[model samples]
Target: MSQKHLTIIDHPLVQHKLTIMRQKDVSTAGFRRLLREISLLLAYEVTRELELTTTRIETPICEMDAPMLEGKKLALISILRAGNGLLDGILEMIPSARVGFVGLYRDPETLQPVQYYNKVPKELDARMTIVVDPMLATGNSLVAAIDLLKQAGAKNLRFLCLLAAPEGVERMRQAHPDVPIFTAALDERLDDHGYIVPGLGDAGDRMFGTK
Candidate 1:
């Protein structure tokens, strides 16, 4: 257990594509496609520290054995609906991993995230969990998602997002300092309306072109 936290990937591939995503002119299809690709790349970064055990596996060519990841019980929890885009890409890479969903919306008056749906794997405690979302603005939903996962006995948790605001990062650090966060880019701040500054706008709407 390491106290060191927070890793904002500054890789050029992530940065360049992240700029394209922020552009207002980017089409919905392009944005959605990019989000998926970005999630795959970002997901790769987030899984770097994944807890893996040494395993022995015989090689096809020789009698030697090597270490391989154990268990297909990883829980990839998506914070719908923007997170669905990310979830798709990650699933492509780790098809055997178990899937979960956490659907939440903000209460206009209280600005609190209300969970409308949550169905996580029963053995959440034994599996490592990855929470995916496109943006982390005020972190209302992210925090709530973490809280819910913790309740489900998910001790090893990692949060992955395409873009994150400073306010969200700070809030998440204060709330979930133990959980590591992986993001494509960290923007300056959140806007007055709680959207990420220079953000692509309501991710669900942008992805689906719905009102």
Candidate 2:
């Protein structure tokens, strides 16, 4: 996957909220609120290509064909903890979307993903699945999560995040070239510790007020 596979959502509102959220002094509650708000905007960008079909319906005055989402309900898979922040807003936008969770934590020494839990909706092969997480840093955990989802029969997939680093995007491109990535901003690069430089800090910590 090249830069063509990456979508940088340059929406003004999303950028504004993201800028505020990136500040060091932002409160946890404020950060959480901003994440939810920005996620709503990102949801619009991520689902823009959803298949649509017209259906016959009787209107107030006459019969007409109205456009509606086509095929199976969308699947929203959260890569646990931090991903939940993005999940909340997207769910609000698409309430009928099926939900799933894949829990993974990074090993401090290796900076690799360690899976602990996995629960995903069935019939993933039939639904358009969107994986949500706030950061695409090292991309190890995300790659592992998507690997599990694909093994379980998910065919269509997309990744949504607040921020992305070049390293993570490249990693995802190499591992899952078919999947498109949507993010609010593409930052400079990832630091030695696998953190996105100029990032707001650990999203899980910022959202939950943890160390």
Candidate 3:
């Protein structure tokens, strides 16, 4: 199905947090903390299509009907380690949302992503899946994740990330343009090393303090 691809780079608070996250000298603890904070901010854009239902309820003073979210739980799929950073923060607000993980790593030979692990909920067909990753550098991993989700019967899909490069966004646009993408900032370009230009460096490494 064709879907509108939306990018969230307009919010000031989002921009500020993203800027801090993108600095080269930021500490690992600080980098991870910022990712968590930015993910919450990005979650606002990702949940725009959530279904809402109306019900009768009573307030402390007034008795009135209110609108609340309906059933068919949401599935927030994280793309392994770095993506896990966002999961905790989003779960803080919507703790009941079902979680899924898709583990994909770049193959040493092809530099292509290889899926090594995937354990999604059994009722994926009835859920709205949002895939989370910190950066969209090559777009291969995100594209691969979306492809796998489609094969699993996930029709409604959205992508949430901290930052996206112009090249990666365009590549994703061509491959899966129907999927909406949410991120705090869109950098000018990707460097020759397959990293976002002026990107904070390997998100996983920086976030984990490994390098």
Candidate 4:
């Protein structure tokens, strides 16, 4: 199901890739590769609304108008660490897109986000910005990341992730209703430890081979 604030990408290829990544036995290399492939698919759905303008072009046989993305190149803000997994694949598709990073770690005890680093592109107000992160479990970190981006003059923004929890989706909706979320799946709920149940474990760990 989809709402104004959230979009679930249920493409068969995406689902198949996600299922493999969920298995505890999947190696770090395998998980990282799958995440990159899935990010390419998710990027399609998330950027569907990009404005386009026709540009005059010459074909071998004739001249014609070709559709091109309008305005300044879009900006992609990776939410650090795990977000880099998704960022890598999307960059392959939009090579000219601007890139930035925001680093925020969740405090295990309080389940809140703590910012540690941030750097974003200039002219955020004039470009469409998309925030990339692998998991949106508690939504605390994602929300905090977006908060910083807005403070930096970003007005148009979107959030993309591999998986999301209902609690996290609602948290984002309540906190930043203007931003839309795109994810491969919306899982059941978050566990007591603030982890998404049936989630693919810690995304950063699975992708980076770290504990």
Candidate 5:
């Protein structure tokens, strides 16, 4: 999956919210609120192709057939702390989605991701799996996370992030072309520190006020 396989959600609302989130002085609560709101919008774009089934139901006016999502429930896998921010908002849109988490922390010296936790719903092969992470900078962690999911039998998968760097996107494309990426913004190069340039700056720290 090259850049062609990536979907940059350039919707006005998404861009506007992302601008606010990128500001240096925004409060933690404000950042969280914007992320949740933007996640709802992104969720709409990503799930546009969901399989639908017709069901007979009674509306306020009369009985009619209604289209509803078909097959197994969707699965949302949040990539640790920052991913949780996007997860909360997406869950609001799909309350029935099964939730999971993959906890990985970057090794300071080597700048590599180390997994500490992994848990996901069963029957992943039967459902669409969306992995959420706020920042896709180095792409190492995202690759590792997807590898774990595939090993667990997840065939259909997607990656969602707020900001993505070219390096990360390319890395993902090479490592897992089968998975399409959905992002709010495709930013400039990653800095030497492995942070996306002009990014919201340490998504987990800003979201949680840890910095």
Candidate 6:
């Protein structure tokens, strides 16, 4: 993966919150809270380059022109289950952004992603799409999700994740070089079972207390 296509958010606050989330003993409530807080920070970074325009507005004392977001509302596409965790927090910051979901599950034996559900807003070609998933271990799910989004007319797209593995990054780079990735931490690698090494285990299970 090219370094230019990936951004490692090494902010102290982000790292600190990620550390708490990675702990084995962290409670469901604590994990969910930290994920929300960290996602707000991530959302700020990902939306840094949003185009701005001036709009005339009246202040308490006088009328003035103020900067505001320009163009169509942004789209946030969550890669189902785990992605919902990140989606909620980012939505808190960008309540006006359009929301979408792609539901997929890994085939236990093949370790490949299988799409079961998908729903996105119309006119995707004009909006900046941000795809969110907690962990990018195998990259199959993300790559598949991107394929569907592109087929649906999404042109400008970005990927956001809490943690990523080297293999997953490489896979995504090969498949979708145009899409840049924003992540909190890039871990060592994927383990034998395709889980990210030193990662917060099973983000969905941890956040929802399923396991």
lDDT of each: 0.84, 0.95, 0.83, 0.94, 0.93, 0.94
The TM-score between candidate 1 and the true structure equals: 0.92
Q: Find the 10 residues in a row with the least total lDDT in model 1.
A: 1-10
Top TM-score hit: 4
* Clash pairs, model 2 backbone: none
Model 4, 1-211: lDDT tens digits are 5789999999999999999999999999999999999999999999999999999999999999999999999999999889999999999999999999998899899999998899999999999999999999999999899889999999999999999999999999999999999999999999999999989899999999997
List, residue by residue over 87-201, the lDDT tens digit for candidate 2: 9999999999999999999999999999999999999999999999999999999999999999999999999999999999999999999999999999999988999999889
- Model 5: how far residue 51 lies from native, Å: 0.6
Model 6: lDDT equals 0.94
Predicted structure 4: lDDT: 0.94
Query: Model 3: how large is the Cα RMSD against the reference?
Result: 2.5
TM-score of 6: 0.97
lDDT measured at residue 145 in model 1 versus the true structure, 0 to 100? 95
Question: What would the TM-scores of all predictions be?
Answer: 0.92, 0.98, 0.93, 0.98, 0.97, 0.97
Model 3, span 20-87: residue lDDT tens: 87788888889888888877877887897799999998899998979898878899999987889888
Off by over 4 Å in 5: 1-3
Better of 1 and 3 by lDDT: 1
Judge candidate 5 at residue 39 and give its lDDT: 95
Cα TM-score of candidate 5: 0.97
**lDDT tens per residue, model 1, 1-211:** 1236667887788888888878878889998888878777877777776656665656777665555677656889999888999999998888888899999997767768999999988888888899999889898889999999999999889988888898888899999999888877778897768888877788888888784
